[model samples]
Target: MVGTYDLHYYQIDQIKRVRIVRRSDGCYVQFCIQADRNVDIQPAGKTIELDVGLSAFYTDSNGLKVDNPRHLRKSEKALKRLQKRVSRKKKGSNNRKRAVKKLGRKHLKVSRQRKDHAVKQALCVVKSNDFVAFEKLQIRNMVKNRRLAKSISDAGWSQFTQWLEYFGKVYGRIVVSVPPQYTSQNCSECGEVVKKSLSMRTHICKCGCVLDRDHNAAINILDKALKQAGYQLSTVGHTETHNAWEPLRW
Candidate 1:
């Protein structure tokens, strides 16, 4: 067989198995290699929480927001054009087949883009902190909301979180997922349940605590993770009831 393949990097480890799969664009080979991937990374001695959102990719506990790429939204115009062409072509015809192929290739491009973005962002987050906390979001349930479903899917939260966990394991960092309940509604400072609609971007509490909604939620996520991990915060010092916390399984 005559074919071309691009090897991005070479693996020195023994290959356990290989598989070939066909995609819209091309056929690709995947290698399952056996090797120890663990690496030594100096502890940053810092913890962070991430709140994923449609408005921004995520807001960190330190008040930093990463803008959402909206990959599908950006490519929707081209995809629509290709799809229309496919529909216009007669069924069981060469023209229709070509048009469909074009549409499929465009979709494959968007998928790769999402994966790239997720991998880079997740690696950065894992490398920057010793402990990472995020919400245990039920993405399947969230996508049932027709009004916000597209936006949620475009954010690629599921892919991002998967990468975060993978990188955490490789780098020997802790990535924990806490319950999503009331993280956004509860005030981080005073523990008051300040109810606000989705339109309300800022969180304001009666106890003189004001913060951006996502920022406040990020802090609350961190707190929840720490408490769950048996860490007690005090003004003078910190106390730990346990030495380690296990990452939640998906």
Candidate 2:
């Protein structure tokens, strides 16, 4: 929605409203089971739910907000161990070949784990919500941050969008994108945009509102989408708490 992009409207459905917000998972939502199943392939619209193996309790003065990601400790440990083992093995030797294979498998496992986690979360978002919000990623400019390119790629925004598209169609959800021009620097509460470097993670508006930069951007995206869908600004936050993406409780 932020950058140069187009929505391929496959079903020719009319969008009543477009609200692009961040992926929010309720308390006790997880996706490890969906990831662990030894199925060769998964069918689309076949909604499967599970606990992602973590407990989350995030709140602020406003109320409970987004759940922090969990289940990454094990994967991080596995990756470090594999990297160390690969380092000690003789290069181009049989032992090195075996080490390389082990490393590859670890990477595969990590990849699969992340994919499973993302899909379940995305699907939950599709099911309980209407207007899905996201930054129109300027992927090219994003990739230009050479140091962060790999991690950003790993975050899989595009893949999440792709999955959102599939689930949106399946559940009759409307997807919308807004100009991602200033979702971060601009305050979602107040219409103010400031040019800040990427390192500034906190958005402090002179209007006496301070918010985490990423979250500020996320809600702004939702605002933009709703406007495009012809909804008045007053109705935007009316259902914030009641309309949360609640998946299977752990």
Candidate 3:
């Protein structure tokens, strides 16, 4: 069996278990190793809240927008071609089986891409901030809308959040999931309710807080999380110097 084993580089002294799986490309062997590693948590660091969406992968409290690399959407045409090719093949034929395998491989590639992106992005976010806050999104319920179901699924918010939580546990970071209620409706600067429809992208508050809806929500999410964690906000007025946070186009 062809395999990759580099224990010296990993400093893996003991193998506890191993599992092998066959894929369309080749066989994959997973090794479970036992080793000592140091995982330290910083007590004081920058806090950030994220508002995830289809417009961008996530908009942070710092107004930084991470572009969503929609892998499935990008490969949709190729996937459709592969599916069409498979449908045209005769049942119980070798060609049919090969076509199916090719389709499966393409799907596996997309899944891997989504997972890789989520892991890297989550790791970076967690490492940069001591406390990470985000909306507790109910993806299953949200996807019930037929119009947005495809886009919501393609965003892979659940996968990204899972990795964020996993990494948070591993690195001893504080990850908080706040209630989604009024996060967008409530003005981030003036504590006023700025009601808006789903079509509204900009949050225009009567109190003079004009900002991107998602960016405002992100700030509110961070504020809510900080309050829950006993971090008090300054009572100073919402001056530009105090509340200069706004979305910047990349």
Candidate 4:
């Protein structure tokens, strides 16, 4: 795979494997169904063992692209069923323990599925290109955004970055984290900061450039990082910082 080292476009695929051999009706066990390199076994005791696996993904034109329609649907249904069961369980009863176990198993399944999705997307991007760029959003703060909380978490951009970094080390691919600064606001054409509401999907700049908000942001972040040596982005308008990091943290 030395040629992968010199390739300008690569389609890297990242996948996460989870060990979830549990059941709901007590008749079936469901291990992670996503693509996996394989399974690793490490002994702990006479009978106990551990399974370890890493998540993977790639990038794309719009951004990181990972999709698994069937797997996602299955995970969603299991989660909904588990949620209802947990919600009905009594506070400190044995039923609660059962419910919690079921819920935990469900979460493990979903987490693996999600991580797989992210890795697949990130890998695609990385393998498709020599240089991969993604927005460095403050994941903690973004999760608090009431409107986008679910979708943002579902997207798992932060996890995607972690996977990208892992492959970057192993593959020697250049994975870059660009600033989550005024990527959308700042005009890519003339650098004018066009203020837009959260609802604004199109970045309409006075410089006559109209681009998808996220794409605009992505391109700007990429260019800015390319321009700056130290490569720090001004998160002046994107974050919710309370300290003295003006023009750097919102």
| Alpha-carbon lDDT of model 3 | 0.80
Which predicted model would earn the best lDDT? 1
Poorly placed runs, candidate 4 (over 4 Å): 1-80, 87-96, 229-250
Model 4 Cα lDDT, one tens digit per residue, 1-250: 2322333332333223434334543433232333334223221111100000111122233443233224544678777888898889888999988888888777767777788776885555445444445666787887797866656666666787788767655444455676666766788667899998877867898778887665566557656544452432354222232121222211
Worst 10 residues of 3 by lDDT: 241-250
**TM-scores for every candidate against the unseen true structure:** 0.88, 0.61, 0.83, 0.60
The lowest-lDDT stretch of 10 consecutive residues in candidate 2 is: 46-55
Off by over 4 Å in 1: 1-14, 234-250
Ranking by TM-score: 1, 3, 2, 4
lDDT of 1: 0.84
Evaluated with TM-score, which candidate comes out highest?
Answer: 1
Stretches > 4 Å off in candidate 2: 1-84, 87-92, 235-250
- State which candidate, 1 or 2, has the greater TM-score: 1
Task: Report lDDT (Cα) of residue 134, candidate 2.
Answer: 54
TM-score of candidate 1 to 2 decimals: 0.88
Q: Model 2, range 138-159, lDDT digits (tens) per residue?
A: 7668779897665555555566
Q: What TM-score would you give candidate 2 relative to the actual structure?
A: 0.61
Name every residue pair that clashes in candidate 3: none
lDDT of 1 by residue, 189-215 (tens): 889999988889999999999999999
